[model samples]
Target chain A: MSEKVLMKGNEALAEAAIRCGCTHFFGYPITPQTELSEYMAKQMPKRGGLYLQAESEIAAINMVLGAASAGVRVMTSSSSPGISLKCEGISYLIGSDLPCVIVNMQRGGPGLGGIQPAQSDYFQATRALGHGDGHAIVLAPATVQEVVNTTTLAFDLADIYRTPVMILGDGALGQMMEPIDFAEVPRRQCPAKDWACTGTGMKRPHNIVNSLYIQPEDLERLVEERFERYAKIEAEEALWEEQNTEDTELVLVAYGITARIAKSAMNMAREKGLKVGLVRPITLWPFPKKPLDKLSATAKRFLCVELSMGQMVEDVRLVVNGRAPVDFFGRTGGMLMTPAELLAQIEERMGK
Target chain B: MSADLSFLHSPRITLITGHYGTGKTNVAVNLALALRLSLSPIALADLDIVNPYFRSADARQALESAGVEVILPAYANTNVDVPSLPARVASVFDRPDLHAVLDVGGDDAGATALGQYASRLEECGYRMLAVINARRPEIARPEDAVAMLRAIEQASHLKVTGLINNTHLCEETTPQTVESSFQYADQCARLSGVPLVLTTAEERIAAQLQRPDLLPIRLYTKNYLERF
Candidate 1:
């Protein structure tokens, strides 16, 4: 058995990235997510790795793009506002087919709303991570252990698909301390970065890492190819966890911290002789629709709970597609819904 | 397997300070709860302003429910970034019957907040314990540990009279990890001119060891969202 260690969620992710052979980390300091950059600043130098504190979030992500272009596992992290600043760089990375990990320790935001945990960036993360038709592989981790496992996986996924992967964590998940077994991190095989521009040394053809395509036909073909890859990802990479949904009338859909809270609510509702279960989406972008679609066959109602005002609820509604009544419950602007509050909402939605 | 914690005997005030990520808050929380078993009118003050994530004040409900008075800064549990110290901190000294525990923040920046209460802490003859975690990279060596201790002492304008070896990797800690850290702790104590008062291990690991000074503890630091 691997040793279990108590670690903060943000710090665990940074360590996991290091252990997975990430050599360069570029990031700016932001609340809730600063610990990750701080940890990297301390540990990276010791390991002969590069840890650069960029002037701004924009500068940090561009630096990540430059590092990833050299065929190394690279990463950057920030909170909601900072992530928003990196949107252009993220789009450029995806358009250029560069593989790198980006962490968003999410805080409440439309524009720096608050420095507390929030899932309000659901639309931004899933619908549009940046100003392009590109999609990022967004993995949401609920526990400190998952932060390690998912972060390690994030690097592999990014490389496997040659796309930017986002580890979407809220402030609560970043700040929380939990015991985790690091031995459980599953290692995956990543393909060699043959396309990287390592100064060819006048040997092979020059590899141009650029997203700009002058001809409309060429750009359209590139976008079409990326969409084909995304289609394959959507079909194969949607991951989720279902608890007590085998035979229940009501199913609660949530992710991240809200999912954990909803699980408690489901357990309490079950104890009260109510048929309630939980569907937690581990992959936020590849939305985990099939399992919820399967549950819609028997479940009489669906409740979408989030830390935002019905952002993920839209995805739930789209998946349910009128098969059952999908109700929405959320608390925006960094307010947390207690288990009791979630249970009350569930009970109310169930008409009990 | 209950090793004696006699080192905690009859201190009117105890200040817990250490480098960041040294598990000072966890030790302080456990000490407060343990002190409640024998002492009366115990107060656990949260003076941590550096790291916003883990603080003694986050466990206010548990400590208060266990009859431990919790003194926290204004909006300690909220997302406010202001490091405003509360007026109630002064009240901890008002009651002579109170056995107050100060969970100071980590590093010199964190310990600087303690400087405001230095006169009171000195007047009360407080016992400040420098918690050391040998696994943390910054304090992995005795020289680094001593440097950190000096930084904390200088910043807080207080002296550390004792040392507490709390060397463990979060969930990865084992008996060997604790045993191996003993030399680092001993060297640190010898160099800093402070007595190594106690060593700590998780209860499960401590049960397998026969060390007399080992204090077995259940980890109390958890996610704020986690319910009791």
Candidate 2:
């Protein structure tokens, strides 16, 4: 039987990491998510686990890379600015095809932005992390329980794909307490770690996990192999949550905290005699493209609401392919469009 | 800002700010009530869009019963008539209503929305005060706190008039911390050229944390003050 306790998204994430057998966690502290580190700070030490609060995000994420190379489940976390610092490390992690977890309890940021909830990092997390031809499996979780659920999935997906994964969130979700059930993953679900360094011995002579490419041919082959793996990952793993999409006329595409708010707004829109629905992407990178393709056929229009101005809307338009009208409403720099505000957008979009 | 105006003007607008777990919202609510007793018309607008727990709105019904104006965004999608800004609230800011307090979300990004009311606030002569709880955020270091204040000021497009020192750990808060809070207030006053407006009192826990220089405090407990 599963026992549940009210936990913040961050705390739930910590529990998930433990259940995933992540014995090493390296991170620096940042706002809207100090609780995760605080919890880890207490629990990791007691469990004979390693929790190192590195000097900076760069150092912390690099530590994650080192631990993951040795085939131990590892993670690092930060809010926006700190995540910006982690970008260099993340690019390297992806380049090397190392498996690790990066939890960004997102706060507002262009530079040193406020510690309020924001979906602005969508663009940063998805694209433009270092100047690299690389991609991370980004998981956008909406609730506290999903925090644990997605985190466990992050570790699983990381090992399977040999890639880094990120769980994106905002301050509200990070700090708010909610009911959470703590359940152990089935032992059979644990990752098989054959390809890892694991201190290879005399039989293999030596094991190497390096992003370096001294020879041009080797580099080209490595890049092609990485892309091929990405292709397979994309084919197998893409998650989206659908609501009333079967015959829905209007669709609101959102994720993370905005998805929860959109869910509430969709409920209100229904009450106001409007047939509005939501399409929330759980996997931000392998961004559940099938639903977008399917919804484009039936849903007359789509509105992409985000904390950033129109970044995700761009993605929606791409998937939409002019099948229907696409609109946007957003609040950047730590702003949240209230339920009323979202409902207003829904009404206006419906031309009511 | 004039030195006297900063120090002596009625601190009509009490702006509460702090990290997530601090009692900033409760202090703001209690202070608003204290102001209601002293000043006729009072209002509390919860701008805590970022952090959802322990909001000033939790005490809205009690304050409303005491005839205090509470300005909140409209729940228009509820499909029923729910006032956005209550009549008393709209009226308070409209004319010579005495108290006007804003409970902004944590910091500047939350305060950024205050820019929309710059003209009206300037007309009504609202005072902005950044409340600090030194222990939380773990970086409630004076310099860091000052930076947060400057950011809040820039976002609101208004100068903060006074400093409110509300340093307390959860239930671990004590009178010693309250006394030390005065020192924090003094630093803020010197740095921003504002006065230490008020101190808080949890009547039950007062014996453990009493001080001579401290002002009468106002605190909130759900069971005690069923009606504000």
Candidate lDDT (C-alpha), each: 0.87, 0.73
What lDDT is reached at residue A267 by model 2? Answer: 84
lDDT of 1 at A80: 94
Say which candidate scores most in lDDT: 1
Q: After superposition on all CA atoms, how large is the RMSD of candidate 2? A: 12.8
* Chain B TM-score, structure 2: 0.75
DockQ per candidate: 0.30, 0.03
Q: What is the lDDT of candidate 2?
A: 0.73
Supply candidate 1's per-residue lDDT for A254: 86
Candidate 2 TM-score, true structure as reference:
0.66
Per-residue lDDT over B6-37 for candidate 2, one digit per residue giving the tens place of the 0 to 100 score: 23226455566543444557766766666666
Q: Native-vs-model 1 lDDT? A: 0.87
Deviation in angstroms for A25 in model 2?
1.2
Q: How well does candidate 2 reproduce the true complex, by DockQ? A: 0.03
- The candidate scoring highest on DockQ is 1
Candidate 1, position A178, lDDT: 65
Q: Model 1, range B151-223, lDDT digits (tens) per residue?
A: 9999999999889899887666778989888888999999999999888788899898887787888776653
Model 2 iRMS: 14.0
TM-score of candidate 1 restricted to chain B? 0.94
Off by over 4 Å in 1: B1-12, B21-23, B29-43, B61-70, B87-99, B115-124, B132-151, B154-157, B165-193, B199-228
